[model samples]
Target: MLHYFFKIYLKLTGWKATGPVPKDLKKFIMVVGPHTSSSDVFMGFAFRSVLKLKHIKFIAKQELFKPPFGFLFRQAGGVPVDRFNKNNFVDQVAEMFIQNESFAIALSPEGTRKKVDRLRTGFYHIAKKANVPIVMLAFDFEHKEFRFAPLFFTTDDEAADYNKILTFFTSVKGKNPELGLEHLLN
Candidate 1:
């Protein structure tokens, strides 16, 4: 019911997903990039629904789990995580992949809505630690499309891997173009 509703909603809004869908994989990290606006949450939900990926989950800063919008985030499959604290986040999340037969978490590589000098490394580390593939999901607001790059397993070379990730997202335009990840391309 909700899936069909969102499917129609996306179609009506002229938003569609491009590239391949990971239907076979049971566990992996879905990296959604150029998260320049909060509206990306709704689009993320719409894409999750339209893709029929029920296991897709997200993590937000613990602050967002507070009053008012907190309940909404929780209802949207959000798990509040402490961003400031190291707290062995990578190991903890990696353990989750080990325990669950099927788990997929979508994370914003930018780590914040505002523009940054470089992309965060947590998502890559999580994928490496969990021994799962990384799938790129770009919110290309310029083209009004959600783009997916083919899933790829992480290698021992971190810098080279990040280069690949940046290459895939360089052309994507976020809702707030100025706040997007284009700067990282330099």
Candidate 2:
């Protein structure tokens, strides 16, 4: 019922989804991109509903799970992560993935809605350590579409891998003007 509602909401809002739906869903890291607004979460939720993804989870700050919002986060398939604990979060998530073969975690490489120069590398490390593909999903408000790109295989050359990611984002239109990567090309 909730999923159907979200689907309807997405359609009403003129959001179209593109690309092939993932078939080999053993385990993966769903990397959402160009996250510049809270609306991105709504779009992602709608995509998850329309995709009918199962056993998928996303990371959130531990504080969101501390009080009145904890239940809401859990209900939304959020995994509370303590970023300040100094523990190796990527390794911890990788271990979790190894332990649960069906886990599919979503991560926003931007790490925030504000503009950032570089993406966080935690997703890459986690995907590499877990030996799972990184599924790239982008929300392009200008195109009014949600595009899913091919799964990324993490290689030893982190910079090269990031360049591929940047290229993918470059192909996506409607990126928030403030979050634009014009500086990356210079």
In order, the Cα lDDT scores of the candidates are 0.87, 0.81
Supply candidate 1's per-residue lDDT for 26: 95
TM-score of each: 0.88, 0.90
1-89 per-residue lDDT for model 2 (tens digits): 98889888888888887886675687899888777787788778888887787467988778999777689899989988777876789
Against the true structure, whose lDDT is highest? 1
Task: Name every residue pair that clashes in candidate 1.
Answer: none
Model 1 agreement with the true structure over 1-186: per-residue lDDT tens digits: 878889888888899889998877899999998898999988898888888886788877789999988998888888777767766778778878899999899999988899898898888989988899999999999899899999999998888899899999888988988997667765
Cα displacement (angstroms), candidate 1, residue 20, comes to: 0.9
Question: Which segments of candidate 1 are over 4 A away from where they belong?
Answer: 61-74, 80-87
Off by over 4 Å in 2: 84-86
lDDT at 7, model 2? 84
lDDT of 1 at 35: 90
